[model samples]
Target: MEALGDRESWAAVVKEEEEEEEEEEEEGDSANNIGDAIASTDDEDALKRRISAHPLYGKLVEMHLDCLKVSVMGDVAGDLDHHETRYQQQPKDCNKYPQKMLHQSDLDHFMEAYCVALSKLREAMEEPQQKSMAFISSMHSQLQEMSAIPIAHSNAPAHPLPPPTSSSGK
Candidate 1:
């Protein structure tokens, strides 16, 4: 009877230890999951902030929107031109004459917007071109400096080569 009691106690202790270990593993998994979720959220927010704050990103987005506006304006202008041409071809015939397509005020507005967009695009292009030119100039100067450096060879003369003489006497 005493031996049986000792065996029962040992079994109980073992079961308790297993349950504790399982609970600990579950807790660790939950912590890892929570950490991953937080990290993912942080990364997404950081990306959004970076995109919104980037100088080039804003410029690119503006340019894209301007281009879209310009495209729409061009389409409208084309349609107007077509109508004007048809009207001109048949000015006397009311049936063939084209009706008023777009208001002059609307055209003026779109034109102004188009001009502004073009100006902005040109400005953007100029900045990059200026930077590129400066970079090119710097690189050219560096190359010139590098070329001016005299290289030493084992079997070459210290002085530069003499000018070649004509085969025929001058």
Candidate 2:
């Protein structure tokens, strides 16, 4: 019955292989289930993962301290070697700027004046100053500060930015 003994040993090996395969699949399934449960809980963390490694802020507004908004832009634009855009190294004379700067409102009266242009953000995208948290946000996006450029040049191309796309779709 040597053949019968050989058959039994072969069957035992096949059975052991099947059991190991099932165990490995179960471990992979358990990891995926935990990942799915955690994904639904934290959306902001997910968004950050999708965003590109662009600078946290823009570059030009740091060029000088002309207005309250410009001064705030300066802080966001600091530490620039890591950024995508080009910026001038501030001159040693630039360091002579007052250690203390004026409050935003003290620098701009129109911060209160709501012109059709200036007032629109106050009307549309945001609430009135009395209700707004803009001052406390610590940073604002590049688009919000464009209206008050200290100097203007026509050659600056009016190239529209491409619409945003998620990482998966692209």
Best by lDDT: 1
Candidate 1 local accuracy as lDDT?
Answer: 0.63
The reply for model 2, stretches above 4 Å from the true place, is: 43-170
Model 1 scores a TM of 0.29
Query: TM-score of predicted model 2?
Result: 0.25
Task: Report, for every candidate in turn, its global Cα lDDT versus the true structure.
Answer: 0.63, 0.46
Angstrom error of the Cα, residue 146, model 2: value is 80
State the lDDT of candidate 2 residue by residue for 1-170, as single tens digits.
99999999999999999999999999999998888778855655644332211121112233221222322334563534323234334322322334232233432332233223333432443344424566555345554565556443444656756889779955
**Candidate 1 on 86-167: residue-level lDDT in tens?**
6446424322322332224554455456557766775675676678789999999999987777666435677879999878
* Candidate 2, residue 129: lDDT: 42
